[model samples]
Target: MPESLMMAFSWLDWLALGWFFACWAWYYEYSRRRQRSKRCLAGVMHGYRYDWMRRLLGREARIADATIMTHLERNGAFFASSTLLILAALFGLMGTTERALLVLADLPFAASSPSRLGLELKLLLLIGLFIYAFFTFTWSMRQYNFCAILIGSAPAADEKDSTPGLRKMFAIQAANVIDLAANQFNYGLRAYYFGLALLAWFLHPLAFILATAGVVGVLFRREFHSKTLKALAAGRDLDITFRGILQHEETTSESLKSQNK
Candidate 1:
């Protein structure tokens, strides 16, 4: 880069910004690997998704499954729309950057402020983060649409042409599609979390670094050791019980049909 462009930030500021991005990337990679081999939230939820798809294959009525998929797609759509609004607001903020800097300067404990150019660069970085989030959210929505189609095409329980192995394969493939969609949604949400941490950059580079680390720590705890994870893990472990419940439901449905006939 040109020296003129580099003049906006000190060496320490550059180091802090580097550390912020490094932490985000490092934690993302770590979580991805850990989830594959451990009982993290992602892993647990994937097992549930597998079960959901398997159960879906045996059911004649799929209103509940379709409704569940609709909810998931809505979540992705909501975030995608929100990201656009946030991007618009950030762009508008660029117009008032000088006034914003003046307000920051008046604060008693505020550290040495960045140049207007540096402030604009930071805002641009935030805009970039949300842009990535928006893309992920939209992609996730598309994947959920694929999952819906998979559900619609699933073999019926009494299909003479469909073997047990074929149905099982279909369930696994459908579950995997849903899992990929969910992972994309997670990535988008993670971007939002890290973007919030980047806001501390306006105050001080050290604050930015600390905030970034804090976000990573919070994410680690929630994904690995939270009460929600424990609940899901317990549910995952009760596979036999869940299967029995499904069987009971199937028997009850048959009984009701017979009574109506």
Candidate 2:
């Protein structure tokens, strides 16, 4: 591209966008690996979820498992609806982007009014994030449905007892399905978290950078150092443990209890 086209926005704007993506990717990879071995929130919950399913082998009534899955599916459904609405609103802005750019041009800290192409690219970036979230959320819903099916199909304790090692295999498999669904849902929610930082771009590139840093800091603290992680770890009985960032099934269980009462 020629300098004329490139100069439609300041170098700062491009740098800020680049920096945000860099940080986003770094945090994702770091948290993913750390979750495997560390006592992070997600890892700990995985332990509990596994134990929960494992214990169900001995139970005749599995109302608790159904309620837990319902809560999770509801959570995913809410985000899926949100993403669809946001994407619709974003696309509606496409025709009026120039006018929005006009408004942006009047802002006190505006760098340079970007070209029509530039604004369209930014809009596409936002749309893309929401689209990703939508798929992730819906997929999570499907996975939760699969989890319910797995729970329903579980063999009775006496049946498993006769099979020696079969109970452990069944428990691990069931927990793995549930954990994978929750993981995708977390990724969708993380996109929303990063999307807030991206919104600062509409204000100013400097604001964008600061917002990205702030959001990342908040996320890092919640994932690695939050009191929630400690609480979950404290609640650990049996072999359950934790590792990182995301929360676990205890909240669902509590919510279920509240609703029942």
Candidate 3:
């Protein structure tokens, strides 16, 4: 490669790498916060009586409420915005705009002979972006469909006559819907971040690999060590505690009433 070409490629490569790392950090932090909030909320719902947890993390947990419509709105916005950004990036990568502007202004990069290596790199990035976009959109659509089912089926009538199994089923469905929505949002956001990294690759191929690694690192933290995961586990514990307490209270009340009578 010519010295100038090499320099251009090197600069782009570094930019892509930096972007990838930055995105990874962003996601890691977000997931950590989310996990913490989830745990605190779970504690509150299950009557864990953790005043400090509530004081420090209550708002976050509230944000994670499985039924919150805001979560849905956020997901929708992410999908929409990501779709637009990705489309723009794709068009830019295709040089369509550059070609159109050729009549108006002479741009040096636009006029240079296309490099086989550069063209191949661009193609690879395009394919990756397309795959990520498709998966993110499709998954989000499926989650939205699941949410619709949940909205339609959720309890509207008195449950006095409903069997335990029926109630359990409803709870399961609700949980499933929440899980699906969360996953879709996570995947979609990651795709958007990756698209940015792909754009960075217009500068260099190594940048793409760096960005990929950074993203992977963030994902690892979220999946394994994030506060959100801890909170989720804690929430389960709180649920059991609350159920036990409720059962005990009912039993004690029944006995006391029988004796009084």
- Most accurate candidate by TM-score: 1
TM-score of model 3 vs. true structure: 0.55
Candidate 2, residue 21: the lDDT equals 93
lDDT leaderboard ranking: 1, 2, 3
| lDDT of prediction 3 | 0.56
Candidates, ranked, TM-score: 1, 2, 3
Give me the displacement of residue 181 in model 2, in angstroms.
0.6
TM-score of every prediction relative to native: 0.90, 0.85, 0.55
RMSD of 2: 9.7
Residue pairs clashing, model 2: 38-243, 39-242, 39-243, 40-243, 40-244, 41-244, 44-241, 44-242, 44-243, 223-245
lDDT of 3 by residue, 17-71 (tens): 5666576677657654664343433222323323322222223333233344445
Give the alpha carbon lDDT tens digit for every residue of 36-60 in model 2. Answer: 6447878888888878887898888
Pairing residues by index, what is the TM-score of model 1? 0.90
What is candidate 2's local distance difference test score? 0.86
Per-candidate local distance difference test: 0.90, 0.86, 0.56
What are the per-residue Cα lDDT tens digits for candidate 1 across 228-257? 998888877787678889999999999999
Candidate 1 overall lDDT versus native? 0.90
